[model samples]
Target: MCPHFSTGWGNDAMTSTIVFDPLLPWWLIALLALVTACGIALALVRGLSGWPLRALAGAVILAALTGPVYQQEDRKPLTDIVLLLEDESASQRLAERGETTASAAETLAARIEARDNTELRRITVPDGTDNAGTEAMTALSEALAEEPRGRIAGAILLSDGRIHDMDRAPDMPAPLHLLHTGRSDDWDRRLRIDNAPAFAILGEEVSMTLTITDEGAAPEGVRDVPLDISIDGDEPQRFNVPLGREIELPLSLPHGGRNVLQFTTPYVDGELTDRNNTALVQINGVRDRLSVLLVSGEPHAGGRTWRNLLKSDSSVDLVHFTILRPPEKQDGVPVRELSLIAFPTRELFLEKIDDFDLIIFDRYKRRGILPSIYLENVRNYVEKGGAVLIAAGPDFASADSLYRTPIEPIVPARPTARVIEERYRPKVSELGQRHPVTAGLEQEFDGEWGRWMRQIEVEQTAGDMVMTGKDDRPLLVLDRVGEGRIALLASDHAWLWNRGYEGGGPQLELLRRLAHWMMKEPELEEEALWAEATGQRMRIIRRSLSGDIGDVTITSPSGETFERSLEEVSPGRFETQFGGPEIGLYRLENGDQSAVIGLGPAAPVEFEQTIASAAPLAPMLEQSGGGALALEDGMPRIRDVRPGRPAAGRGWIGLTPRGAFETASVTQTALLPAWAVLLLISALVVGGWLREGRR
Candidate 1:
């Protein structure tokens, strides 16, 4: 091996020195002054003076080239001992790994701190966000930069042996030692979803891939685990999941809505923990086809409203059931004695109740023609995930209104027989402004909207009053009973608004939303709870008919509680967002109102289970010739293991002559004095001038 050498004069001790004096180089200055004087004299006499000018210029250059520089002197050398410390991150926080690290750290710190001629510095690491493990390599690089390379003795790392930023690790000034924190028994079981999509079309089947792995400390055995999956708030399906393998599960959504699919694995007896057992995913289902059943009591101007609304939708399958005339109505009729055939209430309401997506009752009254049993069947249809809409005219407020029938039990409002005939423009209530149904529709009409000639005086009960007519009375009512939805448009004259009676309103949009909400689309829900997240920051929003909401109790991924009251912005919607602590599945619960949302992956702190093992970091750590040693092996006492030599071995390589420089003071000495520099420079200048003078 080549011995270290200093980049300076070898074997030479003393060099000549010249004292600082302006007169030492004054001869050159005087020569230049005399040359210039002669040049000026010759120029004034109009003779050849170029020779004197050149001489003067040469002298000036000579003086500047001979400036002073101090020479090296005898001095004491400093043997700097660089302390390269590697920190243990969350990965190092493995179950028994941390304890191993603590013992190794104390031993190494004591050994280095007790050294007499050395100093010890530490690079500590806190927790990292996301899944990035401890940046021990990066921290070491920065610490190395701030310290002197010549003083670096070696580097000591106390970690779970897991480092993510190996590319940023700096070339060590000395040997690097990795005292990993972990035991041979260190192991973990993690739940991982190998694949998932952002959105799934409604009524369509989607597949998700999942995997379960047994990490370090995991027992070497095959076991069956319970994995539960749920869509929306429905009953969960459980499976006897196998460990250390990949599985594919097929999921089918029943409706067009936002399904929050949760995948959970029951905690095992010997498992590290259950922090990673649950995961939440939000998927939006697409609605491409709509089946609408339009029932018309009598053919009127409002009959066109129902037809126009349903016809506007190309995907809608409209089955219109218009009772043109009751079976009893006969005006001089012939043999049949009936103007119209009997209505198919049985087949429509019972036989194929699920075929139609939404059923509309337009100005239908309690006409004795349809039996109460048929109406009761309709009520059951509404409860079984079916949509219903009611467009009431004056007949709705009368004794024959459906509100007076068995259907009233599911109706959101109680209709008053009093008919409001005054023409006035209908407007969205405060709640409607933020409501998905009427939110952006108001901006469509800049001027005064046309008016509706007649309105029903209805008292809203369990529904949302999105639109108001005649002094903010509920002109529209929407409610949800069981798993289905209902929308009530009190005024049949809503079509009159489209006729430009006063100015023409957003009649088309209002009716369109009314129909869509009845279909049970998520974005159209009157009461909703959802969240949007970027990194650890989250913005939570809640939509409800309640004017004021209580504290929104938030359950963090680590099972921590964060509560805050939501601000009521509209008549129905309340909202708030928070910068959460860590990443994972977060739950929002207000009283009995509870919702689950995902922030990041699992418990952010132990996402990777920081344990000082060489498995994950072998490739990079081996490049530095640094071998990972388990702290459970009883820290192989820190030794000055020469570079390129085996860093760790059987017996502890304890630092020699411990605390050798404990009381040693550190002081920096100047290599040369100002006077010595000036003197040395003068001698060189005089010597060069004398040699040139001889030439």
Candidate 2:
């Protein structure tokens, strides 16, 4: 089928003449013999002595030099082939290169199969993990080694120009050709969050920096983006967030809790994809420790409630002062006979007020035990980041209540005179459900909650009514005044709740949470955003008052921006997870909130995906004058490409014909046998002797 082919004579039909002349080849044998005879004749004409010996030596030298041999048979020359190496790396999988490579491989394979003299060999390359590039050249070297170098003609390569293993290229038997794939106009954009901290102190100002970038196909002059930030699910604050710059935002945590900061940029309406929009971070909030002064007005059934809750945790140091007797209303017995210890008001509240984090007034009245100046000092304590709790009995609505004292300026509400005794089950309000202290309580209740025996109705004008008593009056209220916090549990029946006298509630846990919250524990605060990352994926959570969270903005390490939304599964918890393409610290902002989370290991996925092809073999195929075609492409037709001709064409490369000596049958003739030499010597000697005698 190949046009370059020629029919060769059969072995039996082809017979060439053999010559046994070492001085010349068969073509020059006649001339060499003539030259030798001329030499011998010239010696005789010159009348030279030993002319026969001279002629004999000349003839022997000529025979050895000619190296004459007899030809046996000749064989047909084999066709040379060229192989094409194709690239199969991860980068090749991008765009339509994979499809192109596959098509080329098939086309070349068919062409090789159709040609009688050509064969197709497929060498597929797998991508090495961890960003190692394609090994196409290595594959070509291997293919070259397996086949005979003399038979190879040329090679072709099908690839994207991303070959990584160039160091081990082999000596090519043919020329190499490259066919590259890819379009020039590809582009992309990504959201990036540059740096965020993992821990920040509660109630302290912490700064976070954010950045955004455009990748691949960025439009020119995109600027002045608006970004929203939120902390612990507060109201979103918008800023004229500049593009291509790191913005420093100063943030202060309001309470001690797990502070989840979510940062986000608005999703660009017309973008390729929203996958890279928002970022999230979760930081734990902690206070140095809360020191409380427990002032016992008089020992009562509920007195232990305050002590038990505060003392249960080792972090809180309680300075308990019990007033056994008043200076005016003392019993006739001596002070030493009294069971209770004398109140240390001057030592606890007066001298050491600064050392206390919070002070509890348990049913204390204007008993004239302390001066009004001391009460004023307590109010100053509340103004300077201090906390206070009031456990009121019926005396709270009376004329002797602390509201009548100097501390009332910092008091949120004045207790009304009305007090109602009624049984009620403790329940969390809508706000309380989201508050960190109450969110997970549903699991503990198991549908049956504990009941309180009695609650006092109080009229509240300010603060949140977290718990209700009979007729829905606020039984427990929390309020902020100045720089301090105050809470009031109006009834003393909380101890009954813990005792389970009315079918126990989460009294211990609730009381514990309330006390800690009052003390400003970070996890007990409401409204937060946080994230945890495992490798390239991240799990983001937003805890907020609003059950539904808007889209979150994420910034990646490469300065790309993306937006994501939070789905609320519980009352106040909103959450989602995303796969991060790169490994770095990412910043997430939801509205005015922001957090930082990590993505990917410092080292990413171990192996990169390699496209399956063998383009690196192209050079070897070309050098061998063989066409390296993809098996996926049509296999090239192998024809006799002339040995000294260009390697590529419709057919295979030519194989060179060997010299005649390659097929010649070799024979060796010794100068003479030992017996012939001895006889020659004897004849010479006998002739010499006879001649001498005649002389």
TM-score leader: 1
lDDT of 2 by residue, 215-323 (tens): 4445678887777777655677887777777777777766554565666667664443333445556666676566778877767887887788778878778887666
Across residues 1-695, which tens digit of lDDT does each residue of candidate 1 receive?
Answer: 11222232433322223322233466766776667667657655764324344444444444443443333233234444645454556555546555666666677778777765577887786555566667777788788888766567666677766666777778764556676666666555677775577677766778888877777667665677788887654578888888877888788766665567778887767665566666667776777678888888867897987798788879888888777766555565542323356557678777887888888888887756567887787788888878888988888988778888878889999986799989777888877776778876768777778777889999998877878999889988778888788888888887776677666777777777777777766667766776777777787778775666688888886789988878876556677878887656678877556666767653354454533466655654455455556666665766665556655566454222221112223222323445655566556556545644565
lDDT of each: 0.69, 0.64
lDDT comparing candidate 1 with the true structure: 0.69
TM-score of each candidate? 0.69, 0.49
> In candidate 2, which residue ranges exceed 4 Å CA deviation?
1-290, 328-347, 350-354, 440-443, 447-453, 547-549, 602-695
After best superposition, candidate 2 residue 62: deviation in angstroms?
58
- What would you estimate as the lDDT of candidate 2? 0.64
Error of 2 at 459 (Å): 1.9
Q: Per-residue error at 120 for model 2, in Å?
A: 11
Q: Best candidate per lDDT, number?
A: 1
Give me the displacement of residue 94 in model 2, in angstroms.
18
lDDT of 1 at 121: 83
